[model samples]
Target chain A: QKEVEQDPGPLSVPEGAIVSLNCTYSNSAFQYFMWYRQYSRKGPELLMYTYSSGNKEDGRFTAQVDKSSKYISLFIRDSQPSDSATYLCAMRDAQGGSEKLVFGKGTKLTVNP
Target chain B: GAGVSQSPRYKVAKRGQDVALRCDPISGHVSLFWYQQALGQGPEFLTYFQNEAQLDKSGLPSDRFFAERPEGSVSTLKIQRTQQEDSAVYLCASSPDGNTEAFFGQGTRLTVV
Candidate 1:
């Protein structure tokens, strides 16, 4: 099994709808969780970052991590058409001075007008 | 530009031909990373460098895949004899340090035919 697993959903929703994206990791040593958004022909852009387990909010995005369950989530409120992109979840262990990140397959989201 | 930059934007190579992709990281960044993103998948770590020193290359898939940050700035990923499976987007990212978030380049899309 892959270290990190995510449902590759081509989820389509209307504007203003709430979107929830999730990923589950099997590694227990992951301490840093991150969400990245990638558009066509572009690199992944960091959207939200969280340390260990807990919740973090930024603008219309909220990220949650549950170390106990090995799960992480990204919630988008008031989603817009501009939000259409691939959402990727990535994690890294706290192996001092190491910055390697393990990533999920990514879920494609499209918010319609 | 303030962001990381990758060259050739797109490359098409014949099977068994060698190819090299270049990345120019953000100025003054200390940590550089190389990743491979296959179609419909998330980016996977390939190698990492701390300045001119490659500290981790455990993610490289084969001996044909080689990366080097010769001057601790601009780095290159070279494939000795490319195969169809080598077709993917090569992403380069840089951070101020190991403890900070990374900034990524648009990436170079390589197609081996």
Candidate 2:
């Protein structure tokens, strides 16, 4: 199985809708979870980051991690057209020596007016 | 520089040609990483450097790919005899330290014909 798995969603939603993007990992050693947003022709931009389990909130975005289930999620509340982009989930273990991030296939999202 | 910068924002090369991509990371950052992102996929880790020392390169796809950070500030990724499969957007990211949040560059998109 791949280390990280995310649905390649071409999800379409109306403005102001709540959007949830999720990813699951098979590697139990992963300790840091991150969410990135990428627009076409640009690189991925860091959105939210969390260590271990639990949840973190920043403005209209929230990130959640469940280490017990090896799953992670990003929720966008009252989404806007500016939120239309590809969301990527990334994780890395606390190996101390190496911090290479493992990423899943991103989910493409489009928020229409 | 305020952010990570990559050169040759777009590159097109014939198959079997050798190509060199450059990355200028944020000043004083201790960690530098290179990732490859294919069309519609999230970025995949390729290699990492801690200052001028390369600590991990386990994700390099093959012997044809090589990366170096001679002065610890500017890094370069060189692909020898590139193939069509080598076509992808090469991204560079850097962080203040090993375990901190990383900032990415506007990647260099490479297309091999």
Candidate 3:
């Protein structure tokens, strides 16, 4: 099984709609969960990060992690066209130094105006 | 104030040719990372450096791929005898420390034809 799995969604939503992106992992050691946004032909940008299991909110974006279920999610409220991008979920074990990140195939999100 | 920067934003090389991609991390950052992103996939870790020391290279796919951060600030990923499978975006990122969030470069899109 892949270490991390995500739906490669070309999910289309109208502007102002809410969007949810999710990923599941098999590794129970992963402690740092992150969400990245990537545009076509560009590198992925870190959007939200969370340590362990909890919910973190920053502006219109929220990140939630459930270590028990090995699931992580990124929720975008009031989505806009500019929010269209590939959403990637990545995790790193708490080994404390330069640990490699495991990533899921990103889900493409398109918010139509 | 500068984010991570990469040179030769786009590169096209014939198969079997060698290619070198450079990355300039945010100043004073202590950790540097290299990742590869194939089309429609999320970035995967390649190697990591803590300052000038290469601490983890377990993620490197093969001997043909090598990365170095000789000066502890700027880094390079060199692909020897590039193959068509090497066609992907090479991303560089840096964090203030191993436990911090990372900032990524725009990435170098390498196409091996």
lDDT of each: 0.95, 0.95, 0.93
Model 2: per-residue lDDT, tens digit, A1-113? 88999999899999999999999999998999999999989888999999999999999999999999999999999999999999999999997689999999999999999
Q: Which ten residues in a row have the lowest lDDT in candidate 3 chain A?
A: A94-103
DockQ result, candidate 3? 0.78
Q: Which stretches of candidate 1 lie over 4 Å from their true place?
A: none
User: What are the per-residue Cα lDDT tens digits for candidate 1 across A19-78?
Assistant: 999999999989999999999999999999899989999999999999999999999999
Top-down DockQ ranking: 2, 1, 3
- Chain A only: TM-score of every candidate? 0.97, 0.98, 0.97
lDDT for model 3 comes to: 0.93
TM-score of each: 0.98, 0.98, 0.97
Better-scoring candidate (TM-score), 2 or 3: 2
Q: To one decimal place, how large is model 2's interface RMSD in Å?
A: 0.7
Q: Which is the better candidate, 2 or 3, if ranked by DockQ? A: 2
Off by over 4 Å in 3: none
DockQ of each: 0.79, 0.87, 0.78
Q: Which pairs clash in model 2?
A: none
Model 1: per-residue Cα lDDT over B45-88, one tens digit each:
99999999999999999999999998999999999889999999
Two-way TM-score contest, 1 vs 3, winner? 1
Instruction: Tell how far residue B11 is off in model 2, in angstroms.
Output: 0.8
Query: Which residue pairs come into collision in candidate 1?
Result: none
> Chain B TM per candidate, please?
0.98, 0.98, 0.98
Stretches off by above 4 angstroms in model 2 are none
